[model samples]
Target: MRALRYYEEQGLLASARSGSGQRLYADTAVNRVRLIQQLYGAGLSSKTIAELLPCVDAKVSTPESRERLLVERDRINAQIAELILARDRLNDIIDATSKPNPTCDYV
Candidate 1:
C-alpha cells in the first residue's frame, strides 16, 4: 500500500480517496500500473513511459487516439528492428572471432 501510494504521488497511478479516507484504486488503475510495469520491463525509462501514458489511455475507437497508438507501435517496431540488427552484427563478430586463427595456436 505504501509503494502504491508512492507510485500515485509520482503520477504513475491514480488513487481516489473516499469521505472516510480510504484509498480506492479504480479497476482501470490496476491495469494502468501493470502496463507501466510492462513498459518498464521493456527497457523504457520511467519518464518515457509517463510521456506515453496519454496515448496508451486514449480510446481506441477514436481516429486520433488510434493514430497515436499506431505511432507508438511504429516506434516499438523500429526499436525491435534496431535490436535485431545489433544482434545479427554481434553474431557476425562472434563468428569471425571463433574462426581458426591462421597464424596463432599453441603446441
Candidate 2:
C-alpha cells in the first residue's frame, strides 16, 4: 500500500523487490509496521521515530536516546494537560449556555 511505501521512503520500513519488481515483506514486517503505527499514534514525528527505531531494533538504549524519549514523553504529557483544560473550558461554556434566560418572555 501507499502508506507502506511512504514508510519505506522514510526509512521506517524495508522491502525486497521481486524479479517482477513487486515489493516483498518479511513475516516480521507486520510487527514492524504495528510498532511504527504505535509510535506515530503516540505523537512521534517521522524524524524522531527514525532516530528511535535503531535503538529499538538493537534492544539497547544509550543515555542520549533515553533522554530524547524522556523529552518526547514530557511533551506528550504537556499536550494532554492542555487538552484537558480546553475540554473543561468547553464544558463550562456548554453549562452556561444551557441555562434559561430568566427575562425571556418565550420561557
lDDT of 1 by residue, 33-65 (tens): 778788777666667666667666663245654
TM-score of each: 0.56, 0.79
- Runs of candidate 1 with Cα error greater than 4 angstroms are 1-7, 10-12, 16-30, 40-59, 99-107
User: Candidate 1: minimum summed lDDT over ten consecutive residues — where?
Assistant: 59-68
Estimate the TM-score for candidate 1.
Answer: 0.56
Cα-based lDDT at residue 80, candidate 1: 95
In the predicted model 1, the residue pairs found to clash are: none
Best by TM-score: 2
Candidate 2's C-alpha runs over 4 A off are 100-107
List, residue by residue over 1-107, the lDDT tens digit for candidate 2. Answer: 99899999999999999999999999999999999998899889999999999999999999999999999899989999999999999999879878787886763
RMSD in Å for candidate 1, one decimal? 5.4
What is the number of backbone collisions in each predicted candidate, taken in the order shown? 0, 0
